[model samples]
Target: MESSLKIGSAQLGPISLAESRYDVVKRLLALLYKAHSFGVKFIVFPELALTTFFPRYWMTNQVDVDRYFETKMPNEVTQPLFDAAKKLGIGFYLGFAELSEEDNRIRRFNTSILVGPDGKIIGKYRKIHLPGHSEKRDDVPFQHLEKRYFEVGNLGFGTWPVFGTRVGMAICNDRRWPETYRVMALRGARVVVLGFNTPTENINHDEPLHLRMFHHRLVMQAAAYQNGMWIVATAKAGYEDGFHLHGGSCIISPTGEIVSQSTTEDDEVIVYDCNLKLGDYILNSVFNFKKHRRIEHYGPITSQTGVDDLIDVSSKL
Candidate 1:
């Protein structure tokens, strides 16, 4: 396995409604070239990278919403990116809206793909943790309608061998959940790559604006350390059509340290040389699943999804 691999987080700026797919591909290509110059072997782009965060807008017409979803990857609009990566000998992870025909029905998903240096797709992940509500809310400044547009991902969390190391994929809200990383880590994933488009404001409750970015880093850092894996997170940030998304694109080491982070909420690339073995000490000492994990005692994690009523011991007390 390759001990050291350089990765890049390509954080994109706003992609307006007027911007064409061809335009977005051009921006992606520029970042690809920039990372190549820095000797980055792989790069990660943000969720819904091709278009504006359309889920925030309430659209009654299915036709209007379908335009944001891609029927097939590497079609005419995205082939250039594939071709460029092949020529440059770079691999990438990209998140987008996927429209697929499965189980004799058409379905949509918030999805991401891991592409090898040879331009072949290695693995795919759909966002299982679809956040926000399906119903429209006119009271808030905007809506987060992921539940309305996409079905929960059918493909479970998976890991794939990439650049001589095992890597996994996640998207947006999946980062906030511990189960997402644990599943992949159990499968021997040495690194996890993810992309997100998070609004600066929380529509669900009265939340402090600064906590948006704070929690973004908090979850990923904790997961990285606890799971003994590196994490590369990219964001579709800045104001898109006047809606603000925070950008704190970053790379975290297995030790839960921020190796590199983007300074702007715009189109920026941050690169880091990740040592796969950096987590060996952590895994062998504190987090060795084979030796230390006590699954027999952790029944509630998989057996239940939400909290159950606790047994009261008031009489004994």
Candidate 2:
């Protein structure tokens, strides 16, 4: 028996600083309905889907930054999206800024959630690999202050058994790291859905514009093949309030092939009927962790964050 499911990447165009949450949710609803029309059973929306990528600007007032983070999911402003998805029998993955109260402290996180067809949140993953700086930088046109706004994700990489197979979730920068996919794959994830709001320019260093898009695809493609899991990546693209985010939203198969991609850097929906069993060949043969992995030799991956003093091997040679 073939286990298959229809999935989609619901990409959004620019959202200005003034767009209300009401209007943003409306746009999301439109895309959701569009995906539903294509017989998509599950859809992935882009990171920071609600508002403009607010981390680009520097703000001293805590209240100003807090405005962009959602105090609760499916709050009054976003309830319509939930209601409509339930009515349409569609499950979805959504990314946003989360304002949470935990252990008597207010903490914010770059977050995403997996909603089941019944419109209930089945799983959640907070973003762990936050990029950019914590301080204000006046040298660049925009700041990448994700570190200033969000705490490192407290939840571990997790996979949920749903949609006839296990599925996982990641957000933005997390997709760039290999560990994100590997951890999920080790936990039995066959398909990983992620969303990103990637700026076209690199604020940290000088790099070609083309490489930004290239690196985006390269990392995800490599992760998919190495882990033998399908990767569905959606982008919040185009110029938002004059800042550009390149969009190359795509769906990659377990073989590292880009099966479907969005052509335009705008609001677009791309769908594919995915065979969940496609990764079995790779996993059972090349990536059988239980049979092939040597955990004793892989300690540095978790033990060390940066390069240590170089050992002098010339003597041995």
Candidate 3:
């Protein structure tokens, strides 16, 4: 018998920075209800689902930055979401800004959590690929100061066995890197969840606006096909605080075909009945990493090179 899992990609519109946690939770609960109705075993929410993308602005004051971070996962505001999921017996993957204290030191992380069907926290993945700069730049229209606000993720890529399938997660910028999916695939992840808040326009580039959506799907589709895993990518889309975010959330199969996708930049849910056995088929064939990979030749390409290595200094000399 082939094993299968029903997963949902809950694509949400732009969350206003002024919106309270109560309002966010209400929206999330609605999505949960929809996922439950569709018999989805797991739902993946966008990065920073509870709050607006706050890293766009450069905040000098610590107090201002703290407003965007969550002190606890199931605090007063988020408890209702937990309760509803528990009642419905539905598992979910949620992305948020986490604020925690370790050894009397406060640490902040761009994090995602995988909750079991019984509402128990199963796995936590802090985003390792922190994009943008740490300091404020005057030339740029807006700042992407994620590096300044959050610490580098200490938790390595890990997969958990749940709903009879191995699941893994990554957030925002993590999806752009091939290593992110490969790490999870190496751990036997049949399904991978991702959440993103990508801007439609590039502030530093001269590229076309329409290319963002194409690039988004391209990277995700390639990753899924290469890793032989089902990918559920949800996005936080629409305009918020003068920035327009591109939203084209999708569910991709092991064969790299988009199974389901959201059409508009609104609150939408894309569900797919993912047959986990497809992973086995792909891995055994085209994506057979063990049988096909040539690691010895690839190692030299990844090695660090000196500045002179790129220049024909010998010819000049």
Local distance difference test, each candidate: 0.94, 0.93, 0.89
Best by lDDT: 1
Model 1 CA deviation exceeding 4 Å by range: 308-317
Report the number of backbone clashes for model 1.
0
**TM-score of each model, paired residue for residue:** 0.97, 0.97, 0.93
- Residue-level lDDT tens digits of model 1 in 179-240: 99999999999999999999989987877767877889999999999999999999999999
lDDT of 2: 0.93
What TM-score would you give candidate 2 relative to the actual structure?
A: 0.97
Residue 208 accuracy (lDDT) in model 1 = 77
lDDT of 2 by residue, 1-317 (tens): 24899999999999999999899999999999999999999999999999999999999999999999999998999999999999999999999999999999999999999999999999999999999999988888889999999999999999998788899999988888999999999999999999999998888788887898889999999999989999999999999989999999999999999999999988999999999989989999998888999999787788768677444559887
Candidate order by TM-score, decreasing, is: 1, 2, 3
- lDDT (Cα, tens digit) per residue for candidate 3, span 171-276: 9889888889988998988899989998877767866766877778888899999999999999999998778888989999988899999998989998999998
**Candidate number with the higher TM-score (2 or 3):** 2
